[model samples]
Target: MSPLGSRVLGRPDAVQVWRNLANARVNYSVDEVRRPSWNIDVHRTALPAERPGPPEPGGSWEQACRLVRDYEFSPPEIVRALYDPAAPLLGRDMLLEARFHGMHFYCGVRVTGVVDEVRDGTDRVWGWAYETLEGHLERGRATYEVVKRQETGEVLFVVSCHSQGAPTLDRITSLGWRLFGRRTQLRFYHRCAARLRLFVEAELRGREPLPGRSPAVGRLVWAPSDTRTHHRDALAIHRVAPG
Candidate 1:
């Protein structure tokens, strides 16, 4: 059993916490996101594992999946085109601070689903997903998967997510979010797909992994307000569920 509990966020109603998060159903449904309230986005690319395989556990494909699950390529800077540079690593029950186009937001989520498999009928897939917690800006789930086609011997990387904007305290930020958030998010997805593919290919060729840049510096904390001041060098923090 997992150590995480039902309550994952520190603040449940920080903004749009309840209207449309990942907890609405058992598993993600691409079609359900078609509802008027939800905004959907998908990015997929082919990734060659470069080996013939049923993709057994501990194989290259699985290794790639582990990297994704562990957020090895999701450097704080790349996780979002523009970020605070101190965002926490992806994990179950973690709060995150994200910024883009001059807008900032705080949220939380927990690793809720995992995909591990061999050739199931025609494809071998492995990866995991994190479900939005109470204080999340968007109520939904994002899934990253590495798949290998059984017949063609091709491997692919897929990133899919279904979400809708939650209400935010700053209307200007919310407006900007409504207008350009999807585009920025799509960019993030594409970058992740490309990076993961590069890692898989490098492993296959016995080459060294690419060097990481601008690593995150500190733990996440809840920070809320304009009246109070915080140290510039403080560990990155998120004003998650309100205390």
Candidate 2:
């Protein structure tokens, strides 16, 4: 550990720290992760339609894709992400604060791939994926995608992942995983997609989505440049997931 890891815990340089960690490799063997046994999950939700072509300019598909790019769609009540916004989304390093029954645990993940393509006679897809890094609670890869149909102009948000628990030194977390992990995992997958849908729907309705966190909680400083404080200054009547 460097001096930044000292107990004093001053505001260390987040950009530089992430830059350094970006050089580090993911925790698990990428080769084996694709083998059988890892759990796979996929969730999809339809959004408002646009003209049958590329996503409408500034339409729901584009806005939803923006949220996915910046990690804004993540429900903070479940996970709060911190990273270098200045860095390109691909290969970016993320430090995630995953919340469980009120406990906060830190883990690391690195963006592994990105998807942007037009195929199948005119459909367009934009998305990216990240894999768990060393010290993560699990070994996994999750992808976020936004698809716009050419013929019908339908938009959809999709999340797919393959995951399994990893060995860790924390016994309590292991016990918690044994007892409540599956339930919370399902909740996370479902609610994350739901939250993204909520945001895009609100925007399509000509209103801003409300903040998912309390003003007081903004005082908590974890990164040098915290870009994950996503909700605020948006007009809305919608409520985010409760803590």
lDDT (Cα, tens digit) per residue for candidate 1, span 1-243: 011212322323322332223343323334556767886666778766445647655556766876675565453442321122243333444444455553334455666777777655878887777765554556678787888876766777777788876553246445666787777777677667766777777867777565433233233222211112235313333333311
Assess the local accuracy of residue 227 in candidate 2 as a C-alpha lDDT between 0 and 100.
30
Best by TM-score: 2
- lDDT for model 2, on a 0 to 1 scale? 0.67
Clashing pairs in 2: none
> In lDDT terms, how accurate is model 1?
0.54
Off by over 4 Å in 2: 1-20, 34-36, 210-243
| Top model number, lDDT | 2
Predictions in order: lDDT: 0.54, 0.67
